[model samples]
Target: NWRSRIVFLLKTNSSKPMLHLIGNRPSADAVNQWAESLDKLLNGTTVFSIFLKSEFCKENIEFWTACEDFKMLTSRKARASKASNIYEEFIKSEAPQEINLDLHIRNDIIENLQEPATTSFLAAQVKIYSLMENNSYPRFIHSNLYKKLCAAARQEVKYNKS
Candidate 1:
């Protein structure tokens, strides 16, 4: 499973489920759920990142999630390699989608990279997670993108029974 968790930073699971919720806890079926609610708008979803594909900050959620997954890895070897890759792609100043983080956090990650622990990105992950939990998650709930998808799902359900 460490192998799966390692490169997880590089891959996106499109089949990941989307949840339309307004509370911290999810239904029995929520594939991946958030820890808390989103300003009375939405809860969370693993696939919510895809909904943000066209947005400039879309990488925030997914990158945060990837770091979380990477932390869960049981292999130190896997953590060593994945840590640097995630930092290179999402945390570095010149990265394609550099995440906003404190200078201290960046320094800590660089130091951690030398020994690469499972929690190397913990601080950065927390910031990204908060950014999404407070900002993007709420905005996404009100976005037409989610509304249209919900409407289509309802229509499909109705048509299926017809």
Candidate 2:
């Protein structure tokens, strides 16, 4: 009967749109796609950040998020200052948490910082995104931490229904 009831709900629910009442349950595919899931997993929730921090890659997500936010600045003055801050903190050699990037990317960012427009971080951000997508994201999908979070979400939903 539980299976029958579930099937019944699926069939009947089509009559009225079914909204996702629970939150943060990203699908397996979403976990792999960059733009679709990275923001919510990395920036929107503490779970992913906490796990990343433990594994020593939190800086990657933080830098990526800062780049995205920095891109949204409308004022030239704001963009310039933020660009300088990002370069000093994330791009410079011997910085506290220097990201691994190609020399060409670093040099391009250096050149862009001369003017420091909104798009100054574009090339560097792409490189970082690719790094995470190719390297970190797969580990994230398979990590025990992510599995625990998914289990916790399921438990929460089950408990809420009772």
Best by TM-score: 2
- Which of the numbered candidates is closest to the native, going by highest lDDT? 2
Model 1 scores worst on lDDT over the 10 consecutive residues at: 26-35
Record all residue pairs in model 1 with backbone atoms less than 3 Å apart, i.e. clashing: none
| Model 2 clashes, total count | 0
lDDT of 2 by residue, 1-162 (tens): 333332233344243322233244444343344235555456454445555566688777778888989989998888888888888888899877788888998998888886787777788888888877777767766765455445544555666779
RMSD of each: 9.4, 11.4
Segments in model 2 whose C-alpha atoms lie over 4 Å from true places: 1-40
> What's each prediction's TM-score?
0.66, 0.72
lDDT of 1 by residue, 99-160 (tens): 89999999999888878877788888888878877777777666554444454455545666
